[model samples]
Target: MRILRTWECKIDKEIEKCKQQLNILSGVSTNRTTVLKIINDVKKHKDKALAKYSKLYDKAFLSPKDFRVKDNEIEEAYRKISLPFVKSIQRAITNIWTYQEHIRISKVSPLKTGGIVLDTLYSPLESVGVYVPGGAASYPSTVLMNAIPARAAGVNKIIMTTPPSKDGAIPPERLVAAKEAGIREIYKVGGAQAVAALAFGTETIPKVDKIVGPGNVFVTLAKKEIFGYAGIDMLAGPSEVLIIADDHANPSFVASDLLSQAEHAPGISMLVTFSELLVEQVTSELNRQITKLKRYADTKRCLKKFGVIILAKNIDECVEISNKLAPEHLQIMTQNPRALLCNIKHAGAIFLGSYTPVALGDYIAGPSHVLPTSGTARFSSGLSVNDFLKRSSVITYSRSALKTAYNDLAEISGAEGLDAHTRSVQIRLNSRSGF
Candidate 1:
């Protein structure tokens, strides 16, 4: 909604302000207290706490018996949804499953170095919990993105947890997607309570080895809280997109992309471009497009508070600024989008050219849209089959191999004053015939 100079100090402050607004850590003390209480209650009381919060927060009024999604409900879901929607979900499931399988880890052959054999074994997690966020909205895409990868990784069980609508029913779209993704065990619960229920086994909802997906502030905070107890994918914050455009880029396209991100309500949208004329055009287009959105007020507020167009000196400066932010979604709308690829290193996902919008990555694209946010792309990556697999290092040493390294091992253990470690090795060689 405003123009910022690349050299201006206000750039940092403005970005920090919006980040604080978008980050889960920026939540008030009450949120943490609430999340902790819900976690504690769910751990101690189990299904009771789940039911209590389901009634209090989601107003679903589900009981312990109603927590698990029954077969009848899934059958009803098929009846409720349209044929086109089912076909679309089926196609998306195939695409996601194929992509995840392609990138999934494979068996590593043992490395035989003399008498030593070293190998790495990759095994899928026994069970995984997929958290699909719902309160104001339902995310069927989230179901596919989170669950399909686990299935492709050969995980034995994939459980799903999502908030229910006021009518105490999960959305037919989400249910159908879950079925296609091979997630049979689903519970009608969400928010912090849903996360807690997944972390600690309730009477009905079983605990899982790891939890994956995105959610609101409460759910994100709950994931942060239960990280040690139950593995989490990432501490994802609100959605964000950064677009770099040149004068040749279409103003309408740029504005539409920015608006798409802003429609997430608290989403942050930014543009780094050298062309002031394009800025003017995009801003005008934004104003014109703002009136057509269903979520007009929320999107307008997000754009007003968090959106900005930065006037960079050139393409290099644009890339430099983008790397610093490490935005969740980076779109290059320059003449040659791939030309900027080498200079750009930090981004959750990168989309090249004007035709590639962020929504493709969000919904139908093969890659999982569950990406790192809040500058985390510098260190982490998007969710995939890799997250569901655990690796174990296997080592088998022959007698000759152990004897060859015995002296060094003994000396190192001696230096550490661990006599027991040296003795354990020494005992093996004490009565050898050569000795």
Candidate 2:
């Protein structure tokens, strides 16, 4: 990994390049074009397009009838996985449920004005689809994080879609997690095609009101394209972490946290510190740790390409740089981590102290791991129960209220050249109950 001073001109150029890379539709790359074509095909052919892409991309051949995973298969998945694994998933579910329940919005609240009663109602979406990335690896945690919140919000139908292995089977762990999270409907399909199937219904997969989860560039692009057809969580990109540490922070722990994110292959890992000695120690530790990892080649490449250690003037400078980056995961291992949090304006999730690593948050720390990535933390938030609920305003005005406010309403409507709006209010005010 390269070390540079924060004031260097090269840092500005590299940051700009990172911003451009995050833009899925900024340039017409081959990947973007392919995703567009897949979305169009799925929109036109529906189930036929899903089968074609599943075979072509996933090498899993299946017809529309074979799309949804059978109930017997879910039961078999439980039988295949070990008891210890199941117990851990159940524990994590409890943690996630507790967190989601605390954050859930109240069903209804009313605000009474002088004569009008303004009420707000929060209703769960009829159905929601969660995309769990599978194939080479499995993420039961993703299922728990995405499904538990929707269930807490009282969503009627919770659907899950994941890519099948070359043998055309979803991972046993993923299936078990879905079942524990209260998801009954799961489809063995993935990629941009799966996203399209959920947005625009097919023969087997049902159309959902909203879709949430993280995926590859193709899936992200697909979500962007079908956004209007259905509500979507934030458009996520590759995983990333930014650490602000002091000299007191342990070099070994910092290196381990950085490598945890780097092992994600395309993930970005960065450290900004005021102590030059700590930087050297962490850099040496990273080299030693990388040799031991199974994904050494890819992790090393990621560190070289996207990783950096910056020498900041002080802790305030470190905070400034972090706000500018708005990383998906922020770790503060300084002597006073809490004091630094006040200056942190943007970050999807914050991990404090050396003991609290990003892995804890990713697996069992209660918060959903599907965070806003690629500087999107500045505007968006991580997935939660609120994402599955829709808010609508309820206005009730009495006849006397209309009579008192009609002149002012008509004047404003007339100023905007909306005669029909003015007439509608005037007609109400001129009715028998107007007095």
Candidate 3:
């Protein structure tokens, strides 16, 4: 990693690059043409399109009959995973469930005023589809992070979709995680086709009220296009971490955190601190520790493109820059992380102290790892039970209350040139029989 002074012109250039990475839709790979074609093909052909694309992309040949994973397959998945995996999944589920149950929205009594009743009704989505990416690796954590929250929110129907291997097999760990997370419905489909299947529904897969989870460029584009037709969680951009450390912070821990985030090909990692000595120490540690990672090439590439160390005047300057970045993950590896916690205005998730790594949050920290990426943290938040729930403002008024609101309502309706709106209220007020 290279060190750049905060006062240098190069730091401004680097910030612009970070902005570009945060904008998920602007990349060349996000071409809407291919995504639209896939969506339209699936919309028109349904199951046939799904099978065709499954063979083409995932190399898993299947028919409409084989699209949905059966009960036997999930049981088989449990057998394939290790005992330790089961224990780990159980712990993760318990933690996530406990946290979600606590934070979930609940019913509240209506606000009663003079002849008026106002209610805020919270209801879970009827159904939700979770899209888990399939590749060389299986993201069991992804399954837990997405589905557990929905389940906790009281969503009755939770289905999952993931790509299959050439052998027409989904990852056993992923399947086990899905089952554990309260998702019984698993689909053997992936990519834009899978998203389309979920959004529009098919002969096999049921249409969901909303879709939640992350994916590759294609999956992301599919979610972006399918937003209004069905609800979407968020258009998550590249994963990123901004680490603010002090001279007292452990250089090795800071470097490892940055490298772990860099494992994502398009991921970003930054170090903003006041100590030039700490910057040098971390850079040295990054060079030493990165060689040990399995995904060395990708991590190296990520660091080369999106990694930087900024020499700040103090922790306050670091916080100010961090607010502007609105990073997906903000790790404060300072001497006193909580001392500066109140000033952190942006960031999807903040990991405080030297011991709390983003990886812990990614796996078992009880918060959904499905967080808003890029600068979206400024306006949005990480996934939780709340995302799976919708609120409706319910209002009721007695005849006396209507009379009280009549003048203002009629005046506003008339000003807007909506005669029917005013008449609708007048028709009720004018009725002598009701009074």
Candidate 4:
């Protein structure tokens, strides 16, 4: 792992060599054709598709009746959990709501143009479908991340779907998070089935205006297939973290941060630093600490595949390379984080300083854990309240205003070779005398 001498040349060549694997990140296959077939089948069959996929993938049998969680389950969950945990979830929700509200942009009117008004109308989607990953791990955080944004944007109806267990019961923590976020509708559906049900409504589940949240490969592919049918947050890939550190960065801190994402799965985690000496120290630290960790095998594989100890010549060179990568999460652990912030052009989320790790932002930091991956941050953004809302461009012109701009409109319309568009404007010009 000693990438020295012409280190930049080696790093760039190796990055190109791994481009194919890094492109899709779609677990087993990227067979979009089969995924489309599944999407179309679900669109046509509805609840039948849900049942078939549930059996085929999750090996769980469920019906529409089993979709709804009982009231007693919620009460039981509260009874079983600690009071302090409940309070913490409440506090996190409050902070998330406040931050989103402060950033929410309101419709504005342009006052410069006399008698002509242009505004942007913002309104929430009528309904949203949130998919929370299940099985071995249940993320109440996913529920909060997806639902709170829709609730903050004033989405009228929020429907949630999670995979049912073999007993055909949804997890209580997910249910608690749903209820706390004002999500009234719940369904026990997951994977491609859940995406299908949300995209093309089943007999029981209403079609949602937009679908949001993260899932496995099947779910991600299904979202890709159903995008035009319904709005999606983003085509999420494997969880990723890119740390840009310096010699000042602690080796243990660097190792811990890298392993934090590596523990997510087998294709996450990357570390790039300016100091070659620091990379050696951090790699040794990772080996020392990973042996003591529970998920050593998976972490080791992740580190072997996508995990890298890139050595850059200088801090500016490291920043340049990071912009090219545009990772889902970027951690800047060098001195003067504020000075470097201006250079970070692309990232799903940036964690500044040694104290702010990606782990903290993943849980209680109040921003969002659902982020864009696989270099999508170059074009898209992370999940937020803005994802739940739609904007309509507004235009209003008085007769006087129309008279003033009639010539310009006609000229552009005629130049574009649309006679009807030109005639439409000409008609207004012929009839207008207000000016």
Candidate 5:
């Protein structure tokens, strides 16, 4: 890893390069065009298109009957995994459920003043489609994080989709996790096509009210394109972590935490601190640790390409840089993590102290690991139970209340040249006296 002073002119160039790597554009690209074509093909051919794409992209040929995972398959998955592993998934489910229940949004009671009653009703979505990435590796934790919250929100139907392997089967661990999280309606499909199947519904897959989870560039682009057709969580990019450390921090722990995120292959890991010696120490530690990991080559490429070690003038400067980046995961390993937290304006998840690594949030931590990425934390938030629920405003006005506010309503509507709106209110008021 390269270390540089924050004041250097190269910092701006590096920041721009990072943003470009995020590829946060709606412009024309070969990938975007291909995704668009795939979406259109899926829309037109439906289940047949899904099968064709599965064969072409995933090299897994399947018929419509084989799209949804069978109950027998889930049972077989349970038998394949160890009992202790199943128990661990169950334990994690409890933790996630407990946290989601505490934070679940509640319906507000009617607020009555004079004769007007205003209220809001919160209701769970009837159905939701969760996209769990598969193919190279299984993300069972993602199943727990996304489905548990939806279940807690009282979502009646939760449908899940993942890419099938060359053998045209979902991973056993993923199936086990989905079953433990109370998600039985799972389909063996993935990628942009899976997203399309969820949005538009094939003969085998049922269309859902909302879609959630993380995927690669093509999947993210598919979500962006089909957003209006079906509600979607944020368009997630590659995983990233920014650590704000100090001289008092542990270099080994810092290096380990950074590698934990970098192991995601395309992930970005950064360190910002005032201690020059700590920078050198963490660099050495990262070099020492990177060689022993299974994903050593991929993680090293990620660190070298997207990672950075910044030498700030002071702790305040460290916080300043962190806020500007608005990273998906922010770890504060300073002398006083809490004191610096108030200064952090944007971050998907904040991990305080050296012991609280981003990995905790990724797996067992109460908060959903699905978070905003690529500076989107400045305006968005992590996934939660609220994402599976919809809120509707309720307005009730009695005759007296309508009469009292008639002129104000008319004035506002008339100002906007909306004569029909003004007249609608006036007619109601006029009828109050038995006209």
Candidate 6:
């Protein structure tokens, strides 16, 4: 694997060396005030800090009556796995519930004017909590990408959790992908005291308004310190890709899409190109396909420290250093990747050609492999059904529409000091004269 100064690189020092190489994806190497004092002693001794951090980090011995996971152990984990991994988790939960059942969003106009009326309402978010990471293994594809978009946004109580090995069980293909995403509330609990028992609630879990997946970094700093007491799905980092190749791409399909996101362990796998002979034929096909990789030491330290093979002096300077390294899987492989995808602004998922890798958008290309890493796809997205719905705004007014905006609503509620919102609109226009 060659580096040769990424072929005289200098596009603002390769975008300040990919933002100082994402300071090793700033996460998971513990000690944040000793994991926030064991997640504030599992949020003030809940189930005795989840059976003493499940016997000091999954060496097992959990109790509180073995913390949920029954129903004949989800029919004995669907009769002990493999029926082609249970029909590949029933074809990836029917392609992520038919691609998040087309991210619904309705409730529109109830509009009128003089006798005013307006609208908005969509609801659906009773309970959410989904975690699914079993350390160094078992994801069951993050339980079909966070319970198939909270069961296509009609949520109503999905609850799940992981981490229980060392001998305490819980990973039979993560309860057969949470019982094929219908999620029969399984729990065992993982780090940061399973995100403080799904953000504080303990008699045996059940306090969740929102909490999706992907963890480590003490469960993403205990979901960034219990985000406003709940609701969280982003702040996730570590896991990236950039690709952008040319010179007719493939050196064994760009070394298997840079070791399939560098075995997603301390991951970040760049390869921006303008071809120094296809970066020495994709660095000798990533040293002969990384000796038939099996997470070859975490894909060789993620291709030797946040990999790179950059050359770029064309292909629009490798799409301007992949829009300043906005990679969370941005593959492109040119020669008209849909005419450079109208100058891709930033990417959380792009995968245009070379048989569209990025592992087919990480399992049968529906759209979400829970994206937006470090550069936060230059804003944020991925994980939809608009993140399990919630919207409300509707109004109605009459009395000749408050006497046609009574003095511009008392001059904008007396210019913001809000004098009881301008004497309740001048006591309903001076006791109803509608003036």
Root-mean-square deviation of every model? 1.8, 1.7, 1.5, 2.4, 1.6, 19.1
Per residue, candidate 3 scores C-alpha lDDT tens digits across 1-435 of 667787775666767776886788885463788999999999999999999999999888898899889999988999998999999999999999999999887889999999999999999999999999987679999999999999999999999999999998998999999988889889999999999999999988999999999988889999989989999999977889999899999999999999998898778888899998998888899999999999999899999988878888878889988998999999998888999999999999999998899999999989999998879999999999999999999999999999999999989999999999999998998898765
Residue pairs in collision within model 2: none
Model 5 bad stretches (over 4 Å)? 24-28, 432-435
Model 5 poorest 10 in a row by lDDT: 19-28
Candidate 6 per-residue C-alpha lDDT over 1-435 given as tens digits, one digit per residue, 9 for 90 to 100: 335344565557766766666643354445666667877887788887898888888888888778787789778877888789888778878887887786567667687767888888888789888887787777788778878877787887888888888777886888887887788788888877888888888888978988888877778777877888888888677788888878987778987888888787778888877777888777778888888887787788767877766776778878877887777788888777889989988888888889988876676556669988777787887787778888888787876687678788778888887889777866886783644
The C-alpha lDDT values of all candidates are 0.90, 0.89, 0.91, 0.80, 0.89, 0.79
What is candidate 3's local distance difference test score?
Answer: 0.91
TM-score of each: 0.96, 0.96, 0.97, 0.93, 0.97, 0.34
- Candidate 5, residue 149: the lDDT equals 93
Candidates 1 and 2 compared by lDDT, better number: 1
Clash-forming residue pairs, model 6: none
Off by over 4 Å in 3: none
lDDT, model 1, position 245: 97
Write the number of the candidate with greater lDDT, choosing between 1 and 6.
1
| Model 1 alpha-carbon drift over 4 Å, by segment | 8-22, 431-435
Q: Write the per-residue lDDT of candidate 1 for residues 223-318, one digit (tens) a residue.
A: 999998899999998899999999999999999999999999888899999999999999999999999999999999999988878898888889
Per-residue lDDT of 330-409 in model 4, one digit per residue for the tens? 99988777789999999999999989999777777878789988888888888888888788878888877877887888
- Candidate 4 least-lDDT 10 residues: 1-10
